[model samples]
Target: MNTINTYRKKRFWAAILVVQILLFFIFSKLSIAISMFERFFEIQKEIHQLLFSWIPFSFGDMLYLLLGIYILYSIITFFKKKTRNASLFKILILVNIFYFSYQIFWGMLYFQKPIVEKLPEKEITLEKKKELALKYLEKCKQTRAVVMEDKYGVFQISDVHKIKTEILSQQAKLPSFISSKKAAEINSLKPSLFDGVMSFTGILGYYNPFTSEAQYNTQLPSSYIPFTLAHESSHQLGFAREQEANFIGYLTGIQSSNPELKYSAEYFTLKSLLNSIVYEDEKFVENVISDFSSGMKRDWAYEKQFAAKHQGFLNAFFSFTNNLFLKSNQQEGSVTYSYFIDLLIRYEN
Candidate 1:
């Protein structure tokens, strides 16, 4: 009877290992499928306007509810499951640890190469690049002014419904953005895992041209959330280029009546603009920095303090990931940001 029981235990352990391996393979294949699917539509320039042409609910708002439920369940489970002996709890904890370990080992295995490809290369002349970025910025300002003045910047769900009404009302005037067939396809893309994120709320979502998702940090200061959301959402709309997304998101937020959204937009754009200028001319940066409004200065200080708390983690993660990103993207350094200078100049010129 003892030998029979031992044999059963051994079989169970082996089966568990096999199940884990299968899960890893399944996750990897699913990741690949998502990547391939994103690319198929991404390469099409006209696909942007149709992306959110139809959706039942905003993805981010639903995720908030889901996360809330998960947290509540975890709390309830903790209180309900009180074990008298710590050994049983420890064993259960180890099982959880093993599961998490297996997930991390393979869940993100398919992402590194694509992420690396998005890193900026140093092939372009810095001076010329700045010129290009400035040109783009100038054009963006004009484009933004037109969009803001003409279209409403929706904040709440009510606002979104209102906008939809306006769009439908002007169907005659609305240029056919997509063919009837493609329109159906775009509308069919319900807000899934690929859409709606509370991670960063500025403009971009799962839209990194390279990684197919936004860079999200949940532990960030609450202050940065709105802007981050907009930024990432912009990426989702096929704005594979960073500066364009930044510019569009800033415009979108600034156009909104919401004070928080406006502030986020202004803060992000100002930071990008000032940083560019500062890098190009330190004396100019010093003068501009000294002239900041007291409120702006306070905000800056708050951001700095908050950022400092996460600096070590950011440094380690960025250094490693950026290096990989650069290598994958055929770049020399982890300076994906530097390309924005070129983008700025392109826009300006």
Candidate 2:
């Protein structure tokens, strides 16, 4: 009993120290490091793209290997003659500290933010903004893209049999090292209470855009879930640039036969265009609103509801992160979401 008590106290303090060091690194050294590499971050991003593409191994496999080693260590400790409950307590605390600390460090350093340039207010007339939205939608429709799905409650596509692997292979190919199990894990996720949830660490989802497998909170509303899933899943596949991921996710979701997923993609794409036109042309905005389908109108209403319900924390944190990404990457309003500008430009050309 005394040994167990002694072990527990030591483990607790050690965990506390681990957390302290993690915070210090994030709040101090990380800021300095980011400041120093503010100019080189793009290069780093490019390097990451190359690495994920060429490495041929997924972080999922690496995690499995790591966990296996940890289990081995635990087993060895279990069999050791002098092993005690105290040692087990110490190991558990240490593991927890390391997991959360790594999460904090990754969130601070690599999460992509939207662009922070001042958005033009009262620039585009409502008519013009609507027009541009319709134009984009027309093009999207012409592409045979099945816009993202609705919110509220609906069925999602999770079966591999329902999707074409060739199309997936073409859209955003995964590393071979990505185990079938991990791929299934991604595919098996249903529209539960956990989709699209905002994390306490300011992570909108799991893909830090610079690290291992990406994950989203799963508790988000239905309309946003497919897009968010596609967004972060793009990151997992190693597309680090937010614009690229957004564009890819949009295209991929549209190609999917799932109704809910399709609407989600189209909605966000239209929303992006709407937000973009808010600073540009008026006739474009007018044209879009006039032509939208009734289904779209209903979807927009639900979207507004979802936005009203949870937009406070998620929106504000995204704003802060966007500003950080722009300042760090030498771009102008948080350019994180501004990737849409490039997408619009590319699609237009």
Candidate 3:
């Protein structure tokens, strides 16, 4: 009886996995199905935010913590003769439930449609990328001077709450052709509970599909927080692609009345543009970096110091795993910044 029941358990999850894989393949090719899923996501996001957004703390982070603990407990008990079968069943059930929920909530949106298809097509060129880089470099310098700074002269957001408000406001203003999803007004963004560890992992922020919450590391340098919020909030807007989120974030921030949000967004664009052109024209990139104003230089220096402090094996491992995760979801991977630059250049022209 025990062996038969165990076989049934394995078979049930195997069937679920096969069904999900088939659905994913179909979704990738079926626009109508993808559109239906996008609508489902809108309804799901509303329900999730209603349940979780009111909590001042991160319920999603706690959910992750408890999940980790449960998994660890299962692993420890798996070696025990009396508990091995039960532990196995528990983990299997958990995996199946989470996988199915994740797909139903967020995974299908990755296959909906690429943002580039909605925009005017144009030839991407090296010259155009360089021009944007110089433009953003100057913008960053000017914005940096205007935004508040810390006692040490590094860039600091004057008011995080205002930035959050501005990001939400700007979301509603995004071009209809770009993002047609209903704009979310719920303040679901929260600071992560794993911020101490996230700093070393190089994760800026992540959107929680299950809870419709955006989680950012509170430990980030002040300059990174506002733009990171905008970027993560883009994910909440149903953009599953990383670069698309960045592009949406750029749109969200570039038009904001808040200087704090504008400075962070402009700086991020400058960095992305520079990264895009550095290999093609290293000299130009260096010269542009050298031209940073004293305030911008101090801000850059502080960022470098923060990154240096957290550099280690964990950063590399997280980066590698993150790249794989992105690619699995049809993204261009974290190592590539040109997709956002591609959107930028095409949109600019």
Candidate 4:
């Protein structure tokens, strides 16, 4: 009877897993459902941030740690004959709960109308990208001149507190025509407990859907930190597509009064535009790099060195997995910058 009951429960959850896949796929196409989820997310995130924001350390990180241990233990139990059936039941139940919670809390937002639909569309040209790249390059050089720097002369963010405040205030400044989502003023950005591991994994930061927290790697180059926070915070603001989040983050940063953040935002924009143009004319890309201001050059070199140091199986593996995850969520995969460049070029025009 016990074995029979275990099999029954396992089968039920397995069925639930399949149903959830179909349900999310179906709901992803309905504008009405997407609108409802968008509203629900704003309220749910507000509540969750209110509950979890007080703790200085990341509760989401701890939750992930515990969840990882549980998964490992379940796998171990699968190998033992006495516990195999029970373990299968538990695994199925866990998977069902996780998938349902993920879809409800964060996944459905992926189906929201693409931000591009809200903007004026124009034909993007390589010349337009190159022109914008030069414009941003000059913009970054000017912004970098005023920001604080370390003894090494690399750009340093003296206070993350100021950047967070600026990001919140800038949220309202986002063009109403593009994004109308409500922005909550909670400081839920956190330095991840897994920063060391994240450094080698090619991940700068990530949003914790379960806890309504934004987690950034503390070990990143100073220039990357402020923009990374803006990007992850975009996720908290209900923008799910990676490139859309980047666009939104760029909007927030470029509007900021804080120079640290403005410089970071401008630098990222310069890089993104250059990335889109690199394949068409390699010499043009090199000339632009050569033209970077001395200070900007130092920062760029450190970023390259950091990327080189982390090159190994770990980075490659994570890059592949992240690409797969993005595509699974209906994004243009991790390797492409064209979506963001398309948005940028059209917006600029």
Candidate 5:
């Protein structure tokens, strides 16, 4: 009878897993209803903010740490236990709960109307990209001249707290046509405790959907940090897709009165534009890089060094995994920045 009862429990959990998988397919078919998840998003933000905003450190990171330990412990115990079926049943149940929670909290946002759908459709030309690249080049040079530099002549943010404040303030000013979500003043941004891992993996920053927190790799070059913060905060504002977050981050940073923020955004814009056009017109890309101000050149060199130091098999593996993850969620992978370039062209035009 005990053996029969154990088998029944295993069957029950397995059925729950099947139901959860079915729900994913069902949700994937309902883009219209899934878009409505933004309404629930506001409530979720409020609850998460109330619970996590006052915490000094990343509450979300703490949760992740605990979850990791629990998963490892479960795997170890499963190998040691005689009742392998029961252990499998427990694991299945845990996975079901996690998948369901993820969908309710964040996964559904992937089905929202694509940003490309909101823009006027037109073929963007190579000339237009080149023009924008040159335009941002001038902007970067001009902005780079005014921002503070360290003793090493590299860009350095004077006040991170002020930058965070500026980011929050700009959220209210985002173009209403693109985003209508109310800008909440919850201060849950935190530097990642996993900075070493992040640097090696090429992950600039990430948003914690469960805690409504934005985590950035503080160890990055100053030029990358500000824009990364804005990008992650874009996710906090319900932009699940990476390129959408990039576009929104551009809007937030470009409009800032803060010179550091402006310079960072302009530099990233110039780099991204040049990267997109480099294959088509290597000469033009070379000229653009040559035009970078002395300070911007130093920052670029530092970024290249950082990337070189971290380049290896682990980086390749992470890129592959991230690409698969993005594709699974209906997004272009890390290898393509064209979606962001596409959005920039439409908005700029």
Candidate 6:
């Protein structure tokens, strides 16, 4: 009788999981309802901040660690036990709970109105991209000249705390036409505990929806860190799409008075434009690359070296999985920068 009751419970949870999946599809079609999530964001932020922000270490990272261990232990138990039905039931319940919680906390934000729709309409041309690439190259070079550097003469942030503070402050300054979400002042950013693993996987940063914290890989090159923090924080602001987060990150970083933050944003902008235009004009790309100042050149070299060191099957697998995840969430994936480039061009025009 106990075994039969366990089977019924498993079936019940399985049905709930299926229903939640269907509901997500239904919610995806309801933009107005999804936008309503923005109003609740402040409440969510406050709750999470009150719970986790005071902790010096990353509470989200610890949660991930514990969850990973539980999953492994459950899998081992399923194989070890003669009667595996109970273990399987537990696994089903775990997955259902996770999926439901994810949808409630963050997944609904994916259905919010697209950022591209908020921008001015402009025809993006290859020539325009090339022009912007050159323009930002100069901008990056000039800004790089002023930013502090390490002993290697590569760009380095003098004050990360200040950058984090400024990012929060700049969130309030975003154009009202583009963003209606409240910008809560919370210092919930943390260095990821999985920095080593993240370095190998090419993930610079991520936002923990359950905790409302922005976690960045501390192993990344300094030039990549500030913009990445801005990008992840944008996600914390309830922008779920990758391209939209990138656009918001650019806006936040560029609007800051901090030279370190400004240079990183401009450098990323220049690189993104060049990446979009390189296939169309290799010579032009080469010419632009040659124009990078000495400091900027070293920073670029360091980034390239970091990528080279981490290139492997693991990185490829993670990239593929991440690409699928992005596509499933209505994004163009990591390899495609056109959406972000489009946003930048329209905004610039």
**Strongest candidate by lDDT:** 4
Cα error, residue 20 of model 5, in Å, equals: 1.8
Task: Summarize candidate 6's per-residue lDDT along 75-146 as a digit string, tens digits.
Answer: 888997665887899999899989988888888888888889998899999989988988898888888989
What does candidate 4's lDDT look like per residue over 1-349, in tens digits?
Answer: 9878888888888988998899989998999998899998988999999999999999999999999999999999999999999888888888888998899999999988898988888988888888899999999999999988888899988999889888988987889888899886889999999999999999999999999999999999999999999999899999999999999999999878899999999999999988888999989999999999999999999999999998888899999999999998889989799999988877887
Clashing pairs in 5: none
Candidate number that wins on lDDT, 3 or 4: 4
Ranked by lDDT from best down, the candidates are 4, 3, 6, 5, 2, 1
Assess every candidate by TM-score. Answer: 0.42, 0.49, 0.97, 0.99, 0.97, 0.98
Runs in model 6 lying further than 4 Å from the true structure: none
The alpha-carbon deviation from the true structure for residue 33 of candidate 3, after best TM-score superposition, in angstroms, is: 1.0
Model 5 lDDT, full chain set = 0.87
**Which candidate leads in TM-score?**
4
The TM-score measured for candidate 6 stands at 0.98
lDDT per residue (tens digit) for residues 1-349 in model 2:
8786877677687777677667645643455654444334434444544555344334433554576788788778867757756556656665666655453434333433322121222333345445556765774444323433335323233432233232243344432322111121223212222244453323445453333444455455455666777776555443444665676677667656555556567677877877776566766566676665655555556656655777566678777877776565334445344556545444433
lDDT of 5 at 26: 91
For each of the candidates, give the backbone clash count.
Answer: 45, 58, 0, 0, 0, 0
Candidate 3 lDDT by residue in tens digits, 1-349: 9878987887787777788778778776888888889999999999999999999999998999999999899999999988987788778778878988998799888887788988888888888888888899888888887888789888877778888888989999999988888889898999998899999999999999899999999989988999999999999988989999999999999888899999889999999988888888999999998999999889889999999999999999999999999999988889899789889987887
The list of candidate 4 runs beyond 4 A from truth reads none
Pick by lDDT: 1 or 5, better one: 5
lDDT tens digits, residues 23-75, model 5?
77797788666866778888998899899989988889999999999888788
- What lDDT would each prediction earn against the true structure? 0.43, 0.52, 0.89, 0.92, 0.87, 0.89
Model 1's alpha-carbon lDDT is: 0.43
